[model samples]
Target: MLYLWIKAFHIVFIAAWFAGLFYLPRILVNLAEVPPDSVAERARLIGMAQRLLRFATVLAIPALGLGAWLWLGIGIGKGPGNGWLHAKLALVLLVIGYHHGCGVLLRKFVQGLPTHSPRWYRCFNEVSVLLFAAIVVLVVVKPF
Candidate 1:
């Protein structure tokens, strides 16, 4: 019962965290396209990015924690058939790196500095989708 509850919350928080991962990059795309002198608009977008990042990070902590508890304590992937889980853990690290990357890009934008072109950000935005898809396939298919 505890395991089911943990899994449910884990799914909920994972969905929420991925939601942020998906959107934050789109915001970066907007940040890149903001007119050079559009001070008010740039500020507003930066502010939104900041808040969203914070919100995502807060959710990520618990999501990660619950995931750890389920795996380590509840033994979701203990013993045999753990290869898929190992791969999934690698992808989870990638997700964390991507989340950190968003913060790095946001910091540069907030500092009134030049950054990548909107096209680059558009390309970058697709990364999270790929990661999400890979993780889902690993979790669901478990083809290891």
Candidate 2:
């Protein structure tokens, strides 16, 4: 029962973290498209991005903690033959990197140094989707 509860909240936190991952880059896309003279709009977008990033970070902590508990404490996938868990963890790390990359872009936007076009941001935003798809497949199918 305790394992089930931990798994449940782990899923919840992952979902919430992904929500921020999905939306934060979209915010950057919008920020990139904003007219250079639109100071108020840029500020608003920056504020929104900052808050979202911070919230995402908070969500990630519990998600990671619970996931660690599931893996190391309860031993959901700790066996020698459980290569799927390792693959899933690798993909999760990539997604975490992607999350931090969003923060870097957010900072660039705040500094008035955004170098990517909205089209580029659009493409970047899809990375999370690809990672998410692969992660889900690894978890559900466990295809090694």
Candidate 3:
């Protein structure tokens, strides 16, 4: 019962976190494309990016915490035939890495030194979708 509740919240928070993950890069895309002369627009976009990143970080804590509780505290899926969990964890790490990458890019943008083109950012935005799809498969199918 407790495990089920934890898992439910974990899923909820993860979904929320992914929402930020999906949108943040798009915001970066907009930021990258902002007209250089539009100082007000640039400032607005930067502010939006900063707030979204912080909100995403907040969402991530509970998602990760609930995930840890389910895995380490409850031991809900930590036994034989559970290789899928390991794979899922690896992908989760990649998602975290992607999250960190977003922060790095955000910092670069905030400094007015963004190096990536809008096209590059557009491509990067799809990364979360691919990772999310793979993660869903690992969790639901548990194919191992």
Who is ahead in lDDT, 1 or 3? 1
Model 2: residues with Cα > 4 Å off, grouped in runs: none
Candidate 1 — which residues are off by over 4 angstroms? none
Model 2: which residue pairs collide? none
Worst 10 residues of 2 by lDDT: 106-115
Give model 3 RMSD, 1 decimal.
0.8
Each candidate's TM vs. the true structure? 0.98, 0.96, 0.97
- In model 2, state the lDDT of residue 142: 86
List candidate 3 segments past 4 Å from native.
none
Clashes of each: 0, 0, 0
Query: How well is each residue in 92-124 modelled by candidate 1, as lDDT tens digits?
Result: 999999999999999999887779999999999
- lDDT measured at residue 131 in model 1 versus the true structure, 0 to 100: 97
lDDT of each: 0.95, 0.92, 0.94
Higher-ranked by TM-score: 1 or 3: 1
Candidate 2 clash total? 0
